[model samples]
Target: MLAMIEDRALHTDLALERPVPALQAISHDPSLRTTVALRDGRRLTGVQAQWAYLEQAAAWVDDRFGADADADTVEVLQRWESVLTRLERDPMECAREARLGRQAALLNGFRDREGLPWDAPRLGLIDLQYSDVRPEKGLYHRLLARDRIERVVTDAQAADAVEQPPEDTRAYFRGRCLAKYGQDVAAASWDSVIFDLPGRDSLQRVPMLEPLRGGRDSVGDLIDASDTAADLMAALAAR
Candidate 1:
């Protein structure tokens, strides 16, 4: 906890001129690679395809941004790359991340499309994927553990009371609010009616928000944080 605060204190946002030269450089590179072969005489371009896409990483990214935009975009893209590197480990970590990520998406997608609240009971895809792994062992166990971390990370800024709580107890608290807010966060701020949810069969009470107001801002923040949280969780789980 102390370390996280220190790291946060030392954090600095990179300032770049819009429209960095990344795309231009990528454009200049000949984006191509030799396809590979497969066993059983099955010829597949897996390696070549991967390399080809890697070579064109900056192509799909718009390069017409102004100087400031370019720099900011590049920084965002670099951070995204770092995140991908963290998640792209062995199959075990990938599976867990995939589960956690899909769950986040399932919840967040409602905010983007339904014009509705992010209620909890509407599990849908997340529940389906989660349900298929009933016997929580092997990959599912890792995924469950990862889910706990995901829940923890989603609750960044949980509360800084310990000898060093998480880097931001608020972030974690926000996550707790998000998970508990059900589906009414589009109108009011969570702070308006936050309370503790009943524990699971006599467990300690966990803080939860009654309704997540200021839905736009808070949901957006949760999604952004969840993005990096997914990567970080996958990496740590792998280790």
Candidate 2:
């Protein structure tokens, strides 16, 4: 059934006859073929990608046995590395074959050797566990607590990111506006923020066409000087 669907997709929307430049680039770029990405927007590829897989598998072994991990984890890592190394030879083609129903990308052969049959329900359960977002219940957070998942940023850094937008981007200006005068803001989009002020006949739309223009350095003092949204608008108009 999957193969038939894959065939349909390949011959239709994803057909080689109709080439998308970005997709074509991804096919050729090994760095873009990462199966895992970090929260700090870093891609795991090459040795880093292999190491990530090993780290997860090793952590699982440690979790189960609570023993010296070196020996117990080595065999599993070797198997995973073997599979990943082979896949990396032609990652895009490997992915295509897997999608087009090639019996789960050589892992099925290893499972057969181990006398373990394919288990769709078990796979689905694992997927569900990973996606669970509750910190106490999620598989990922559990691993995170154990320091199994690699940390790209400190807890404080992540918390700070949640509270504030990047200072270098136009989001700083937009975020400051929302934080200060969100009640007056009727609507907002990427390119503009619309304000519905008191005693105003029409909505005031502030254009944000230049992403680099509205950063902290550009508008921080202006925003600081304005007492209200109306004052800010007037100051902008005078400029």
Candidate 3:
């Protein structure tokens, strides 16, 4: 965003005034080494597409701004390159990560060089627009309502997700714990949950390091039968 803005403001004739061509060329390449399926049945191709885009953008920045460019530009680009390179080990994951979402404001800002002045306030508004959570007010929600954006999950599924966790994941157990004993949970993470049970000498840290274990199918009955978190712990320990 900064690069393009500065590019226009200074009349620098660098390539990629808009990222459309670069994104399109990479994504639609016939010789793509990898492809990943989106939930909407679309396929994303190109393993190093994002890495290449960033590299191109970095070059543009260097050419247009020279020493006036941000000091961390190279470092940020390098970091993105490193991450993308590592992701290439899994082509599907790499392809999925390469997918980028953009807002109308951003595209308009890029094209309306004369209208939306390349300034801090405009940039900040564009950057922070998505952070608005209200469905009626948020720019993202408005786009969603207009079907300008694709959804990975439907509204019904999302609503159900609020009250239920996946039956096949360890999240089921964690969700059950929260539902039955949220008051006892002091902290929770992907691999563990800390329980601060009353009358206990110390907090009990339950390690859920096994990602494949503790699903609803494996522990639903046990959880349903247990009256308290301690009872559930005892039942789990018995297993």
Per-residue lDDT, model 2, residue 157, is 97
Provide the RMSD of all predictions against the true structure, rounded to 1 decimal.
Answer: 20.7, 15.9, 17.4
Best by lDDT: 3
In order of lDDT, best first, we have 3, 2, 1
Winner by TM-score: 3
CA lDDT for candidate 3: 0.67
Task: Give the poorly placed runs of model 1, Cα more than 4 Å off.
Answer: 1-51, 59-63, 70-76, 83-89, 93-96, 100-239
Q: Which ten residues in a row have the lowest lDDT in candidate 1?
A: 10-19
* Model 2 residue 20 distance off true place after TM-score fit, in angstroms: 9.4
Comparison by lDDT, 1 against 3, better one: 3
lDDT of 3 by residue, 122-178 (tens): 666755766688887776776667766555578999999999988887899889889
Query: Sorted by TM-score, highest first, which candidate order results?
Result: 3, 2, 1
Better of 2 and 3 by TM-score: 3
lDDT, candidate 2, 79-115, per-residue tens: 5666566566654344322221122333344466666
TM-score, structure 3 vs. true: 0.56
For residue 225, model 2's alpha carbon misses the true position, in angstroms, by: 1.1
